[model samples]
Target: MSEMRLYDAAGNRLYLNAEERAAFLAAARRQSARDRTLCETLHYTGCRASELLEITPARVDLSGGTVTLRSLKKRKDAKGSPRIVYRAVPVPPEYLDTLNTAHGLREAAKSRKKANAPIWPIGRVRLWQIVKRIMIEAGIPDAPHRSPKGLRHGFGINATVNGIPLHMVQKWMGHAQLSTTAIYADAVGREEQDIAARMWG
Candidate 1:
């Protein structure tokens, strides 16, 4: 028997590397601004699909540079009761602008109709379709976990490679356990090489 490999050299999951992520973002940019923002939000925030759908203008704190995500994963409290967890993830300045533009702040400033409106009004099915189309356009072919979750996993790998603290990543990603976020530590990157080199030096 041979050892089975689930993912590529990247890690356990099939996540987008930096180049693939860039390509995806570029392809998204070529689409409508709405699509661009939708893709960017998913990648930048590392949020789940359903959590992305819950984003409303009110939930967006532009001044704070954060997006509050409601984690859909059910967890138990001290009493063993189910509870929903919410987390505020920091948004890159450029991504924040993209979202603001997509939401039509100018119009909302006047009519206020779009103020409380959901950023992406489409349902989960439509959102998935849009993401799949973008993935194909970006030259990311079909594969297992090739949907939005891939993007989310990619964000985790990217963050880990960039030297962000694991606990912070856990908090930002709304993981119920730090262990879930720690798995990104296995992602192959310069961080691994640097740590290995220090031992020899």
Candidate 2:
């Protein structure tokens, strides 16, 4: 017998079609305060769910509307020496309000417990549960390979479709290689083709 691939053999590896994206956002907007913040953070910053859960108040610069993602990827130098690399990603201006709310909630939780802490009080598992619950509530099917990664993919696709340069997307996504960014550019090529068809028609 052959081993099964991690992804479904006959389905899309990613979730969030255009309609589903809209439904997801709308459903997220209807969620409770904390869940709403989590959804907004995931959608706006395109950070991994683990990264979002690791966020600290210090990592978010509300004045600049940016969030720094700590090094999740291992770095290898010319000699194959391993190091850590952090990436700074800009968040949408709208996330400022959501961040402020999340900060306030975290501070309040800390105060109630007499402990100072990070903005997200939950662990990675809890974050996953939160995202899963939100997706299910939004009527999205829970595919094996689909999770908050879909949100990141949606952000990249939308950004590329909107004409953000591949280099910039790479920087925002914290991708070390330009090739990774080009994949997103290629994903948006269909949109470009549709636009061209409209122009010629």
Candidate 3:
């Protein structure tokens, strides 16, 4: 049997450029409201699709403008006991607005769902389908080398490039290992070098 990877194995390993990010968001906006919300949630939170689906209204602390992530990784104690990982991620202002709008729309639709209802009702299969469609609309090739995972990687790379702290990035990504977060540090260094070259030249 092949060894399993912690992260999903799909999409280009490269981070998205500015133009590509714009195209992705534009294409997402043209999609159904549900899809748009999903895209916004993913871009804002940098959480896995499964984690995004698990988000509830209550998980968002509007006053503090943060969203708490209940990490999906399973842990065991020395004696082999089960435990849960959890992290609190900041909510971008725009994302909070999108969530507010989505919540209002849901309420207006007269859905009596509980406040703790899943933010995204779509199943994982449907989520993948939606991602595929959006990628096509955004002019991405229909290949495993450029899928939704690329978007997630893009988010992390972008954050690091913009000088967000590595530890914070790890927390936002819910990564247990600092080494995992270090991968994007190289990208940030490259970005810095490019900026320096432009200034000198």
- lDDT of each prediction vs. the true structure? 0.80, 0.71, 0.72
lDDT of 1: 0.80
Residue pairs with clashing backbones, model 3: 12-145
Q: lDDT ranking from best to worst? A: 1, 3, 2
Report the CA-based lDDT of candidate 3 relative to the real structure.
0.72
| lDDT for each residue of candidate 2 in 1-201, tens digit (9 for 90 to 100) | 243222246755463545556677778888888788888888777787777776666666677778777657667889999976667788776767776775563355345342234566788888878888878888887675347878887777777878888888888877777876676666666646755787799
In candidate 3, position 152 carries an lDDT of 71
| lDDT for each residue of candidate 3 in 43-131, tens digit (9 for 90 to 100) | 77778878877887767776678887788877676888987877788877776777778676345334445557777877888888887
Which stretch of 10 consecutive residues in model 3 shows the poorest summed lDDT? 3-12
- By lDDT, the best candidate is 1
List runs of model 1 lying over 4 Å from the truth.
Answer: 1-13, 105-115, 189-201
Q: How many collisions between residues are there in candidate 1?
A: 0
C-alpha displacement of 114 in model 1, angstroms? 4.6
Error of 1 at 24 (Å): 0.5
Taking the tens digit of each residue's C-alpha lDDT, what string does model 1 give over 1-201?
A: 232222656554477766678899889989898888889889889998999998877777787898888898888899999988888999888888877777865456455567667788899999999999999999986775478988888788888888899999999888877877877886655445655686798
